[model samples]
Target: MGFGHIPFDVSHALAGGMLLMSFVLLYQRRVPGLIAALATQGGLLGLAALWQGWAQGAAGLYLTGLIALVAKAVLIPWALSTLVRRLGMHGSVQTALGIGPSMIAGVGLAALALVVALPVAAGGSALAQEDLAVALSVVLLGMLVMIARRNAIGQVVGLMSMENGLILAAVGVQGLPLLIELSTAALLLVLALVAGVFLTGIRERFDSLDVAFLEDHRGERR
Candidate 1:
């Protein structure tokens, strides 16, 4: 099977779902809710990978899908939730930007992604072009999530979400080595673990997970 055999609507829908989850991540004010949205986005990424695999008849992508589903959707969320509970960060998330502004920024970023990716991918199949556009949108929105939130956990979630976008883009592209996908998935898992440990240390030293406090600590050192 070729890219032409793939249903553009289904692939686009899955990618769009991940993009929508990025928006959801942007507006989420609670740690648990944000984690849930991240998991959902990861799940969508896994499904998109699986869909691409089946459509393209690539067996390696099946493993990629399984890794994404297990690592991103399951393990990462559970780890973040555990960290949140242990750190007693169940309250509303602190944000550097208001919900309205964050959402507006997300919309603008999505438009910018389309503007950049569509032309760049113009020579590709329609599905690939759409995937690239949505994937880029998701990445930008993830960055927005990180910038908008003051919590370290939220930043970690944003990072993970961005990785999801990268994975979607990789899966959309044909003949990408399975090893690269696996390595990317492993790197994301390691990053989440490191961020979790780093968050724990921040909480221990500063007695809070809000990254704004790091600036105050830096000022004190100065």
Candidate 2:
């Protein structure tokens, strides 16, 4: 199955939805809203994977979709939400770059992604080129989210979102091995666990999840 076999419109719509969620993540200043956007993005990524499997006639991608739904959509969000409640951060406001400037930066990053990915994937099918471009945009936007946030949990969500973009790109590429897909899923799980531990430690040490506090502490020590 070739990339051209997949319907360009449908795949683009799903990828575009994920990209929209990335923007939502950036626009959110509340912790709960950020988590909800992350879950929504995950759901869209799962759908995109399932659609790709059907279009590309790849059974492996169905498993990839299932993994994405379970991990990204359900488990990760649930875990993060629970952790937030436990840490008494459910109502905490996330510190971030001003919404206007962040949005402008996001738009610029999206344009840069399209400019880079389109020419790099010029030899591929139109669907391939578009998906690659969108995936890169999602990745760059995720990085933007991380940079804009001062909350540790928000940074973790940004990291997971970046992984979602990688998975999106992998599913779009026909003939990607199942082993690679499985490994990527496993890596996300491990990352979540590690983030949880680190976040707990940070909270305990600083009495807040704001990373700026860590920087202040470091300066105090210095």
Predicted structure with the largest TM-score when compared to the true one: 1
List pairs with backbone clashes in candidate 2.
none
Mark the 10 consecutive residues where model 2 has the least summed lDDT: 1-10
- Superposed by TM-score, candidate 1 places the C-alpha of residue 120 at a distance from the truth, in angstroms, of 0.5
TM-score of 2: 0.94
Tens-digit per-residue lDDT, 157-203, candidate 2? 89999988988998899988998888888888999999999999999
What TM-score should be assigned to candidate 1?
0.95
Best by lDDT: 2
* Candidate 1 lDDT by residue in tens digits, 1-222: 234454666787889899989999998899999999999999999998888888889999889988988988899899888888888888789999999999998999999999999999999877778789999999899999989989899899998898888889998999779878777877887888799889999999989888988988788653
Clashes of each: 0, 0
Give candidate 1 misplaced runs (Cα > 4 Å). 1-6, 220-222
